[model samples]
Target chain A: MLILNVILVIFLIICAVAVERTKDLLGAVIIFAAYSLIMAVLWLMLQAPDIALTEAAIGAGVTTILFIGVISRTRRMEK
Target chain B: MDDIIVKTITRLIVPFIQVYGIFVILHGHISPGGGFSGGAVLGSSMILFTLSFGLPMASRKIPHKVTSILETSGILWYIIIGLAGIYLGGKFLVNKEAGFFMGQAGELISAGIIPLLTLGIGIKVASTMITLFHTIIEED
Candidate 1:
């Protein structure tokens, strides 16, 4: 479990950096969704299933859809 | 966006996701998931349908007016349930002490007003997600 947690933390950091550095708004949004999914997993590992479920729904699910919609409406590539 | 595989898979899985969401909400008092999480799952399934089938077809399944009604009704349901407590000679939202049928501890129908409240919350949350998605996707 400790090793898994470590790996997940590393993956989360990578996703956050990728989201920050990516030039494409869509790609950044996708990465942000991935980061949320990993955070959900971390929450589950900590035995907070309720928080995990909420994170999965709001973070990875609804937020991702909203971001994608905004991207489609406004601009795909950052200036 | 309309890949045949995506459409087919979404059609196959949406029902299961919805059922699981309902199960979670119903068993909230006895289980890990509750109204908020279960409603989110249900809402996500709807959003997934929108993504796979496009806004037109998804809107046909649940139109704007219907979602509006649902959002309002969920809160009304909660208020009505709370009012039931007053009618029963107790404070708002009282449950077991107010003559509700509190079955066995872990039974599906146990927990009196909890399941009812969960249902209302689930409905409200699901509609909120749908409405937000539609509004964001709509015209600037």
Candidate 2:
């Protein structure tokens, strides 16, 4: 279990890096979704079912939707 | 000296930031964190995503009306669950006297209404937070 947690943490760090490296805004959005998915898994391992489900549904599901929506309306016209 | 380095760093890590947000949220019950902490993290994740994706793509995924429903539903669910405790045996949100196994420590159903209450709160907090975040950045 300890080792698993360590691996998970390390992987999460890597994902963080991936999120930062992406240039295209749309690509970054997809990577962010991956991050939310991992976090939901971590929550389940931490004995937080309520949190896990919420994260999965809202964090991954609704949140991703919202981000995409906002981005479409007001793009980075400056660039 | 600092601005270039900061932007470079943020660019590299921004894509995966939402994962960290979930990490904070899922680990809420045991540690000093929970739904609120996690929810905020999730909100930030979405904000950052919007910052990158632009409003058109963002709006295509999450419209304002959906967020409104999510926010209100969460509030209503929390209220209804809390009221259940009042009608059961104790005051509003008094879980121990509500309904559950009410026997043996560490039993699956022992905590009575606590689990249900937590579930409601978790949903309320998570959806509401997401809704608020969406509202702020949503396409008009």
Candidate 3:
């Protein structure tokens, strides 16, 4: 479990950097959603089911929708 | 999307998603979930519908005026429940001692006022999500 936690944490860091370094807005938004999903999974592994559920729903779910809407309404590629 | 597969799958699975959301809200007091999480699940389904079908179709199901009313009503409902406790000679939001039906624990209708509060919160949260999405997507 500790190894799994370490792996997830490392993956989360990678996701965070990838989200930042990406030039495409849509790609960044998608990576952010993946980051939210991974954080939710981490919460589940920590035995915080309630928080895990909230994070998955709000972070990965509605926030993703909002980001998609923003991306569609505005420019998709960053200069 | 114009894609046939996305539309068909969204139509097929939306009902099941809603049912699951309702279950989560209803079973909140007896299980690990509560108003926030359950409401998020319900909100996400509506959001999913909007994603697949577009905002106009989704607006008919939950319009702007109705969403606003429901959101305010949810908060009002919560306060009203708390006031009931005060009216019954207890502190605000008091449960079980305010003459509420305290059925056997771990049952559906057991917790006094908790389920009611959860219902209010669920409605509020769901409507808020829809409203926020609509606001962002609506053209000026």
Using TM-score as the measure, the top candidate is 3
Restricting to chain A, the TM-score for each candidate equals: 0.96, 0.81, 0.94
Candidate number with the higher TM-score (1 or 2): 1
Expressed as tens digits, the lDDT of each residue in B1-140 for candidate 3 is 67789999999998998888888889889887788898888888888888889888888988899999999999999999999999985799988678899899999988899999999999999899888988998878
Question: How well is each residue in A1-79 modelled by candidate 2, as lDDT tens digits?
Answer: 9998888888888888987887767667778888888888899899986677667766676667666766777673324
The digit string of per-residue lDDT tens for model 1 on B16-129 reads 999999998888999898999999999999999998998889889999999999999999999999999888947899887799988899989888899999999999999999
Question: Which regions in candidate 1 have their CA more than 4 angstroms from the true location?
Answer: none
Q: What DockQ, between 0 and 1, does each candidate earn?
A: 0.83, 0.05, 0.85
1 or 3, greater by lDDT:
1
TM-score of each: 0.92, 0.47, 0.94
Residues A16-39 of candidate 1 have per-residue lDDT tens digits of 999989999999999999999999
Worst 10-residue lDDT window for candidate 2 chain A reads A70-79
Cα miss at B89, model 3 (Å)? 3.1
Candidate 2 local lDDT, B37-78, one digit each (tens):
555555555555445665565557666567667667766877
Report the Cα lDDT for candidate 2: 0.64
Please tell me which predicted candidate would have the highest lDDT against the true structure: 1
- Count of backbone collisions in candidate 2: 32
Whole-model alpha-carbon lDDT for candidate 1: 0.92
> Of the pair 1 and 2, which is ahead by lDDT?
1
Q: 1 or 2, which is superior by DockQ?
A: 1
Error of 2 at B132 (Å): 4.7
